[model samples]
Target: MNLATSPATQTAPATLTDFFLKWEKSQPEKIYLRQPVGDAFIDYTWAEVGQQARRMATYLQSLGLPHGSNIGLVSKNCAHWLIADLAIFFSGHVSVPFYATLNAGQIQQVMEHSGCQALFVGKLDDNPNRWAGMKPGVPAGVNLIGFPDYAAINDADLVPWDHIMATCDPLQAVYQPQPDDLYTIIYTSGTTGNPKGVMIDYRAVAEAVSHTSVIMKHNTPNARFFSYLPLCHVAERNVVQATSLATGGTVYFAESLETFAKNLAVAKPTHFLAVPRIWTKFQLGILAKMPQKKLDLFLKIPILSGIVKKKIREGLGLNEAVLILTGAAPMPKSLILWFRRLGIIIQEAYGMTENLGAVSMMPTNDIRDGSVGKVYPGMAVKIDPQTGEILTKSGWLMRGYYKEPTLTASVLQDGWLATGDVGTLDKDGYLTITGRVKEMYKTAKGEYIAPSQIEFGFADNMFVEQICVAGQHLPQPLALIVLSDMGRQAERIAVERSLEDTINALNPKLHNYERVRKVVIVRDPWTVDNNLMTPTMKIKRNVIEARYDAQLQPWYENDEVIIWE
Candidate 1:
């Protein structure tokens, strides 16, 4: 059975700029963004943000670019990132955002593919390899505008943000976008091959924010948000940027990775969203300071439970968090339960770039572990019986993949999006993702196995930081694991024993062919810098499999249950 259809398609759509204008007029002095600078925060009121955006818009128009041109934005999360996006909209241009962690080759591919006439460079890491490497990627003719010089970025040759505001007057009339006008192009962080640009229009954004505001319970004004994730990502764009505009909420930016904790404490966000990896790191950090045995014991006492839970909440800067969300990748059920013990309910959400990141979200009142909640109020979802692939449809679905009509036609069939994810919808309407349709592999016995299903079984084992099951053409699948900090510090014998116990507990539940033959613990961790993982922190399964292909056969033939690489 399919979920309910959204009523938003019949209503007059309101663009993001409409919401921004509403707040700017209603509460001009209200702080809309808090940007961290050193130890202090520089607050930008609704009026101030509007003025800066208008000024930038005017400067953009002065460059003689055609209306509705595509402009590129690359930066880590910052207040100016939103401002740049707003400026792109104000100038009647489509904003194309690139992941800040992307290297020169990747950046060039996207910039050229998107046909960006100009590029805005904002706050990035101090590493020369990052900022310096990006410089060579910009095409020779594309105009460059630098947001106030931060980190290692040199703006001497580019137009300075401060100079533009000083010299140019705010645009007298902002460009008004129609419902069908293209708004932004969000490129997917492809696990394999080149990224595809997802084209979204103003109408789609309106539908997304309208439904998301109600589903996420962000209807009230003055909500607080912390922005750290890449705004380029569809999830972060909707949750932090679009939601703020929809609710007139305040958004705070993290200064850097080193100061993320300190900045989070300052913001005390009312609604928080993080990926599963971040949640895991938080759990590991807590266990590092206070042993799990002690934490579990403290919670058994009524009085100490309150004190301990409150202290932990305050320490994690989630003291005021009313809604906590995790998504982008599947979260382990064990990890969710672990947080529940501390009185923190983490709601898992499911979405993709094609849908503007609005799909299924776990409800606060009725959360089912291992399920990504029910479909959004206006969306419909169903499982394709043949492929076991999840299909969803909503008004917020993307226009199509930019400049890739054949690819677009392949995924968008009639009105339904053929989400490549495999999932099951329960009687209660909750969706449990099983695996990706493209991620399935065949063993030498010609039986197919979904690696995600196997890897998820190992999530409860803290010793395993990251695991990928791979064994194409092999007799049985092999598990490749990267040891976590806790695992590395523990005695080798203990680590081996823990892994063996996990294997014993999990193997019985799997099919004979799907069972893992051995566990290979690799020394190097998968990271974005190494290209073994995406910027969003999802492991690159194909890359990992190819990297250790030769070892797979050798490891499968080994006698020991655990093999060190």
Candidate 2:
């Protein structure tokens, strides 16, 4: 809503490769990327990264691939991931990224759907089961290029990473990408069904990069970012990779989950972004060291509170952070407020794959607790008169779904795309998301229910790791909860009693249709490997409901307040 705008530099780079070249010319010796090897980090200068990417691009060109061909990239976050992406673009190919956690079937579906002529493999994930499914799914006639680490996948056409880098010289062809040129096809990590490819062009990327630079106040090259989130997601693609190229900022990659905390400390990034799940883990880690009551008492004091906050921030490796961002899922307001007490104000953002993840974000200086800031400049937002759904149009919006014009037309209409989120804007233009349009369900009594609101209502209960409220056609809604490690280790009866008390406390705040009448303590938590969550960690409600479908009728009929499943 027209806050004091700190717009990004108008003289942004023409293209991603153009920025790489610009930085290489101006600041060739500056450390642009860092990847942890063993006990130490390996740094790459701007010139070094440019040279490696050029070699990779030359290798792709030597393969006799036609211009504008599709290339698939399958890997976790790493320095090579960025290099491979730049190589693909430099060689005039469109990069199609497959999530590292995708199963073989999903991988096959994406590769075949995108018509990828070649696939690049980097440090694969640890889950052997997911790899097993992926190994056999490589399409016939598609060339395979492996990273240096070479996680074993028995491919006959595999070309080693070292061979490409050592054999191929730097690319000499002076290729340039137009603003309207298709850059990449980012598939949506659908929570309910198959993923859809979102076609993003150079224009959209430029627009998003410029806006992000302004929002982050990344006018200088000193902005440091720790890249741990899945690089395949639009959030990471735009924020870390695109923004780094735009601003000449440095990027540090996390080696693995074990090294995440240590890596964060090493990088001491100036800007940080995380999902709600990661934030919860951080809170839990702090609580393990000190009780909440003790923490509250310390925060109540004056000078001690400031010292404690500084110490806590330093310990968590966020002491240098200028902005902390939370998105990809709804964060509980209670959780946000709790972090504020520790002298951290998390700015929640709202956007999706279709919009290049730049719709609205809370400004750093003026943040409201429950709102996700105002509509960004050069973007128009409105609500559907009938459905009350959020609609937006922006310069960075995707062109359309790849080869799925009918599906694209369903969402994008008359210069505006339905956001599929139910939300309201305050008079000051601050947006508060209510729930997902597709997530609303009606009970047998013809009462509508918004599960996310109820789920977040009980999120303050520390013992709960995750909660999903479902009813469908049932008479009443029920919550399927997975306990935190502390809750699981505690005595079962005590955990159940605490849960019942929490339910009793939350019920009075809900409408008749929104009350959670029953609670099921699930034995196992929902995970990406289990096909119950997207790579971004959003729960697949249909999958979860199907897993417990047989027991739902019985649970609905039973009179127990807390049902142990």
Model 2 score (lDDT): 0.84
Cα shift from native, residue 279, model 1 (Å) = 0.4
Which tens-of-lDDT digit does each residue in 65-173 have in candidate 2? 8898889999899898998998899899899999988767788899989999999887775654545568678788888887776454444467876788788888866
Give the root-mean-square deviation of each candidate in angstroms: 1.3, 2.3
Most accurate candidate by lDDT: 1
The TM-score, computed over Cα atoms with residue i paired to residue i, of candidate 1 is: 0.98
Candidate 1 lDDT by residue in tens digits, 153-183? 4756578898899998998689989989999
> Which pairs clash inside model 2?
none
CA lDDT of each candidate?
0.89, 0.84
lDDT score of model 1? 0.89
